[model samples]
Target: MMKASDLLVRCLEEEGVEYVFGLPGEELEDLLFSLRESEITFIPVRHEQGAAFMADVHGRLTGEAGVCLATLGPGATNLITGVADAHLDKSPLVAITGQGGRERLHKESHQALDIVHMFEPVVKWNSQITDAETIPESVRKAFKLAEFEKPGATHLEFPEDVADEDVTASVLPTRPRVRRPDPDRDSLTRATDLVEAAESPLVLAGNGAVRTRAARRLRQLVEHVGMPVIATYMGKGAVSDRLDASLLTLNSGPVGEAASAMDRADCVIAVGYDIAEHDPKSWNPDRDKTVIHVDHEPAEVYEHYNPDVELVADISATLDELRERLDSVEGPEWCSGLRERIVEDVSRKPDADEPFSVKRTLPYLREAMADGDVLISDVGSHKMAIARHFPSYEPNTCIISNGLASMGIAVPGGIAADLALETNVVVATGDGGFLMNAAEIETATRLDLGFTIVVFNDDDYGLISEKQVEHTGEQFGTGLTNPDFVTFAESFGIEGHRPETWTAVKSTLEDAIASDEMVLVEIPLA
Candidate 1:
């Protein structure tokens, strides 16, 4: 027999949890001790939100469900943003929160706020642990649901009493691997017929296509039949931007070169496309184009997104099955010019003497980073530019939050990406977003992690400011101030560089990526 906390930790080990990012508290002291005696490394963070964001990105990069923990009430409340971000982005995550003793849960209690109830809307499943014997099944279920099809966040609330219980429960054995259902025969045949007959057939890939096997078959489908492809922001690297069949990443909803491709195409093969990333209403406002929806589940109900052929099964298998049915097909005639126009809009190099802008910096950043390097973008005006201009050559390399579109993810996400991938990570964040979780710098530095944080110092909330200007012809309540960024970095015991010229920006990024320590490069935007 052992303590329930120990059993809980063992259950986590069985699920292959290597790290648990969280902040410690009084209520969950037993669990913390249990973690110490186990092999799983507990990563304590400055803020619960940062811990949650770290878990969020780790899940997105690795297929496993990233785990996070916190105490009740305030701590659990702090994690809502990142958990919600994971839910909307479809990243698998399992969040755990500690509560008061079971006796006081029904009455007034310290640090108690019905966390299980609060997390209802954001997670797929959530339950409070009342019995020690239930730990094994609870942990297994949390992981299973979070990592399965249409993956998202799940939650568990462990009361203080439950953690101290003595239980003889053993960790559950790993279950047999069950393969996902294959695409239906008739639906797939109909999909092939549409692709074969349509004058212009396009593949609209999303976040779901970035998985290794799915992305491989997607590229094969594009090659076997000369199909045009347009990726949503989160799906940037689903297909290599270098391919002739690639049009461009879908930036804004109804504008730009990518939208033009949607207009020209007669059939849209939405392989692994999630409506939350880029709503079908944006591309199919007219609801006229035939959409061949291929995903793990049936399409979400929407007037504009009605699919002609719903291939509800394994995405990689569906793509391969569809590829086998079609002969050589032709791409849209407008592919060459559409790609060129998209490239020309953002690839121009600004003279060092000219003012800095998001457009000017991307081409240089693209050149500095290798095709395999990872870039996790925090939401702001810069994200729109990165989505539009930055060309990703590999899947899961360029990460973006299109569903929740959360800010302040860049820093925490960078830390998680570095740990998860065991490689140096780069983050693109604006001034507004950087401050949201800026304290994570201490967390990253303490962990001895190597990464580059490129802060676009605009001294304002640029995304909101730009929108306000477009509507009212002026910006209000959008402007803000900042300290000297270089000085700020020095205070944190890390190197920070503020580049005044385009040449300095180019050299700083290259040098930072080469270094084996944390570095911040601040580019002042005009």
Candidate 2:
């Protein structure tokens, strides 16, 4: 017989888990001890929220269920933001929380709460383990649900006493194979019919297209049919930005060449589109466009998003089938002009005098980084700038939180990217968002991971300030006071730089990357 915590760790090993992120607590002592004897690495983070964010980004990058741990009550509550982020962002994550003994659960136990019920609304599935016999099954089900289609967060609460109990239960072996259903023949044929009949066709890609093999297949379909492709913010790298067929990323408000292309197109083919990324009302205002939806599941019903034909199946398989059905048809000549216009719109250089603008900083940052290097953006005005100006060459390399749009993701997310991909990461965040989870910088230093962080020091919640000024012709309650980031980084044993000129930004970034140490660069706006 073995301890329940030992069996739980064994179960995680069976699922091929490599790491677990969390904070150390008395309630988690047994599990932490078990982790010491196992092959899995336990990453001790400064905060539960930072741990969850790390897991969230790990899941997004690796296509596996990233695991995060916490104690009961406050610890579990602190993890809610990142859990919600993983849920809406469609990343697979398993959140484990330690509770007090089951005996005390009947009373007002210290640090005990109904975490299972609290997590129900945000997770795909949740359970509280009250018996040692349920350890293996609970863990198996949590991973299965978390990594399944339309992946999101799953939760399992283990009471301290239950974790200390001995049991004969063994881990269940994983299923060898799980098959995704194919697109219905009638639906595929109808979708093809709609595409072939239309004079002008456009493709709108979303977060769902960011899956492992989906981007390549989608690119093949776009290239074969010679259609203009527009990506939602989450789908920025679904196709290479350098491709002539690629239109740049779209924002919440439809504008620029992309909006013009959408307006002129007779038919819209939505490939793996998720309305959560951007509302259809913003892009499809009239609800009159003939939309052929191709995704793993049926489109969510909305007044502006009712699809004329839905090919619900595996996205890559559906794209392959669509390509096989279509004959070589010459794309419209107007598509060339639209692509040219989009390229021109995004390629213009900022004036040298505008040293403080994001437009000026982004180009230099891009120049300093390689094509496949990872860039993460926190939710703020800087996020908008990165999404609009940064060009991505590959999928999952340019990370941003669109569905949840959670602040404080960039630093933790950059750490995860560096860990999972073994690549250099550059995180851009506004000053307001940076302070939210700044303690994670020490966590990165402990792990000896090197990444560059650039703080856009506007000393305010720039997005809110912009909106306020736009709406009421004045701003209020968005300003902030900040520390000297250079000195702050020095305190953590990481080098820091403050560049006063736009031209110096690129060289500073290059130096940081060459130093092979984590560095922070603060750019104070004029």
Best by lDDT: 1
Tens-digit lDDT track for model 1 on 1-526?
A: 9999999999999999999999999999999999999999999998999989999999999978899999999999999899999999989999999998999978887777988989999999999999999999999999989988788999999998999999998999767535588988899888889888898888998888884348999999898888889999888888888887877687522247788888888899997788888878878889999999988889898999999989988888888898888998875455777877766766678886889887789888888888888999999999998888888888999999988989999999998999888555799999999999989999999899989999998999999999999999999999999989899989999999998888888899899987889999999987
The alpha-carbon deviation from the true structure for residue 141 of candidate 2, after best TM-score superposition, in angstroms, is: 1.4
TM-scores of the candidates are 0.98, 0.97
lDDT (CA) for every model shown? Answer: 0.88, 0.86
Model 2, position 86, has a per-residue lDDT of: 95
Candidate 2 overall Cα lDDT vs. reference? 0.86
RMSD after CA superposition, every candidate: 1.5, 1.7
Clashes of 1: 0
Could you give candidate 2's per-residue lDDT for residues 114-138 as a string of tens digits? Answer: 8889999999999999888988889
lDDT of 2 at 91: 90
Question: How high a TM-score does candidate 2 get?
Answer: 0.97
lDDT of 2 at 197: 89
C-alpha root-mean-square deviation, candidate 2: 1.7
Worst 10 residues of 2 by lDDT: 248-257
